[model samples]
Target: NLTTNISPLMLMVMSLERYVAVCYPLRHASIITIKNTTLSIIASWTVSLLNNLTRCLFLLQFSLEKLETLLVKDYCYDINWFPDSLRERYDKAYTCLVIISAGLAVISSYTGVVLAARSASTDKVSALKARKTLLLHLVHLGLSLSSTVYHPLLMALSTLVTRIVFVWVQDVFYVIIIILPRCLTSHIYGLNDKTIRPVLLYHLCGQLKISVKPGPC
Candidate 1:
């Protein structure tokens, strides 16, 4: 959950960095200095930690004894942990807030970059690549947000499917919604970044190949 929260925040930071770099190239160095970047990262992690701590407070209403008695399967789901109406409402509200705010920030940042890219002074190729990377960030954000609906979707499917089929479907959703998004960030950046692509591909392909020339974004 900490990682999930931090991921979008980090993406927002990246988007803003690109926004400044493309939209105001002359001022980017001064505006996005190493100290500022470090502080932004620290702030992001702090916010994520605080958010998760608040989430933990929701579990406090349940006594340890009560929690121990609650029946659970071999695997525990977040819905099971948050069985009460209060937690459910809080979860929904928080999820929507994060998705909307982060989505808007990223979209606005990328839109600015795109507009700046059209200017005669900007490097069109670099700006175009940044735009593509931002698009991927949006896709990743959507995938990450989809996990919030996983339980409700599974519950809806449970009535229509057989037990065996439902179990298989659950596994599929678990992988697609809960797992894949976390893994995509590395692949997205690694392939798009020229400096990292060769090294990423070398290790990914068992270190047999030392170089790979990828096409433009």
Candidate 2:
């Protein structure tokens, strides 16, 4: 779906934004000005629209029955959904590109953050904070990519899996993919930021600046 493709693009943009902030503090002002950021976001949405929307159009070319088989949750509905086909090939290639692009962004951003931290002559505290921030970013990216639950080998197993097993696998991983990235990661972001932390804590704890009652683990 468009959402899946855009998720990776958004991650790439955020990585670049962080990279600019840490690696090019002076240049950051001019580089990520409001107009430039707007353009970058517009570009992300445009790419997602082109890539996934084109794929959806391709599905429309097929008959109703064929399109039904080409489901978004086809892994659960049909174990053989990823069978060899032009469409499947394109889908896999698109996924590969998204992952590769995100991987490169992560590497570049993390490297910049580390280098900037080391180069900071006076602000050791800021350097430490940058490192912590990068750590959180790494964790978030992993979770966003569904690395904890979705491995390459397990993905490969999709072609070999039986129906019942594939269904269960799909169901479990779908939750991790959808809910974890969409909801919890945002909370993680808010929890780490100074301005947003108190707001989130107040809503979560039902009190401002008070010891939060232990809720669900």
Instruction: Output the number of the lDDT-best candidate.
Output: 1
Each model's C-alpha lDDT? 0.83, 0.66
Give the per-residue lDDT of model 2 (tens digit) for 1-217.
Answer: 5665566677777777777776666787999988988998899889988986666555445666665656565444222443346766676787778778888887778777777777735255655565666566566666666632354445676779886887787768777775567665565457666667667788888675765343221
Task: Give me the displacement of residue 120 in model 2, in angstroms.
Answer: 4.5
Q: Give every collision pair in model 1.
A: none
Which sections of candidate 2 miss by over 4 Å?
63-84, 120-122, 147-171, 206-217
Model 1: per-residue Cα lDDT over 149-187, one tens digit each: 888888788778887998999999989998898888887
Per-candidate TM equals: 0.85, 0.71
